[model samples]
Target chain A: MKKFEHEVIFCIVNAGFSDAVMDAAREFGARGGTVIRARGTANMEAEKLFGITVQPEKELVMILVKSAIKEDILHALYRAVGLNTPGQGIAFSMPVDQVVGLSEAPIEPKAEEQAE
Target chain B: MSEAITKKEKTPIRARAARAPRGSKRIEQVTAPHKLKLLFTIVNRQKAELYADLLQAYDVNMQMFLSAQGTASTEMLQYLGLGDDEKVVIASIIREDLAADALHMLEEKFRTIKNGKGIAYTVPMSGTIGVAVYQFLCNHRGDRV
Candidate 1:
């Protein structure tokens, strides 16, 4: 199997804001994402330690994209709902070793030229 | 809870003492190297709990299970044996050494089980912002904060 350099973007925001997250990501060229419903277990102790109030319910949006555009997508996400924003979301990326099921490869320059 | 209590009662005092050090040693082994990977499992919603339980048994607890919808068309979904568009996405922070075992367990389940017809993958976490946060994410229960 060939290794396709990819990154998984995890954006955790206040509940019910997954659409906003996806929207921001799409603007920055992300094809699609998976939204997961999660609950934040950060208690008062965590709040005091981090000096931030963590929302109890969180929506985690996971986006798999080409490694090349990972930074662009993350920056777009941060601007939309980052820690300074009302959603108070935290976004991070990790290196994915492999990927499958994506309908199109985001990194193929040939595909883009053919489309044009 | 009852099962745990009963098991505790059944264990001999010396055996329990012997097990305690091994458990602590395992924690030390996981934390000493300080490498982390994120395990992502996409499975049918019904099998999500079972997947989580399997990971927990491997000491890969502290998972985030998210409900998601697959974008595959109906025909594609049926071909993949997915009953519906609904899916469960589980992400757990695990030590690097245990990631292979975790992925293997998930893969076995995916192949043998009817509802486990999804995918499992891992991502390397380059770094965590703070030591306290890293401990909170990776440490097992009662491993000392």
Candidate 2:
């Protein structure tokens, strides 16, 4: 059965590379994306924490892709942007329940196996 | 000199009904504090800048804009904390027609329908203070003299 769903791909990465990231997304089946500057959080412990400055240089990218093409797009991004590599960035997707405007076709999900 | 105390204000006189509704007793009239206010919100900080730019390009006047973290998920079932991603909120009080135009511009430019980059929503306000402030906001884009 076909179902309607949304794919949300967003991540924060090193700054000054928004152009590159957008280019990669277009190559990965995304029509367009937006980038914003941001700062990473401080997660270090208090006592052991030395005065190392966490880089405030960060860019956030969000791309909406078809659910069927999500995996392909993610893999393409990972390969192109060194996402899985150190200091490259982090990216993930969650199902968007409802939206207006950029709605798209639904995809069929695999059938579950019945226990005998 | 002691000012004379005015007699308790008499009940205001009702105006003669020029055009009465046919038979029906119900009266429909727009009330005071009916000005429309719009709150445009976006979570993606990047899209925020673009939106602001688009508004500027369109010469849309903005009354006020505020930036802050989103608190929508604070009471969610999961303790899912709010991420460090900051949200930019733009608020403007405009005439109803202008608000509609602003919404159209947002849809045309931002494409909020698409996935995660950002989403924009608007809410209406009932009223505002000061004619001077109102005039200033209405002409904020510098397009209107």
| lDDT score, candidate 1, position A77 | 83
The DockQ for candidate 2, computed on C-alphas, is 0.04
lDDT of each: 0.76, 0.55
TM-score of 1: 0.51
Native-vs-model 1 lDDT?
0.76
Name the runs in model 1 displaced over 4 angstroms: A1-4, A41-54, A105-116, B1-38, B46-83, B91-119, B125-145
| TM-score of model 2 vs. true structure | 0.39
Docking level for model 2? incorrect
Give all candidate RMSDs, comma-separated: 13.1, 14.0
Query: Which ten-residue region of model 1 chain B has the weakest summed lDDT?
Result: B69-78
**Candidate 2 lDDT, tens digit per residue, B21-135?**
5454545453343255453435455556566766654334663555544322223533565453466655444555455566666666555434334454444445677876765
User: What TM-score against the true chain A does chain A of each candidate get?
Assistant: 0.78, 0.68
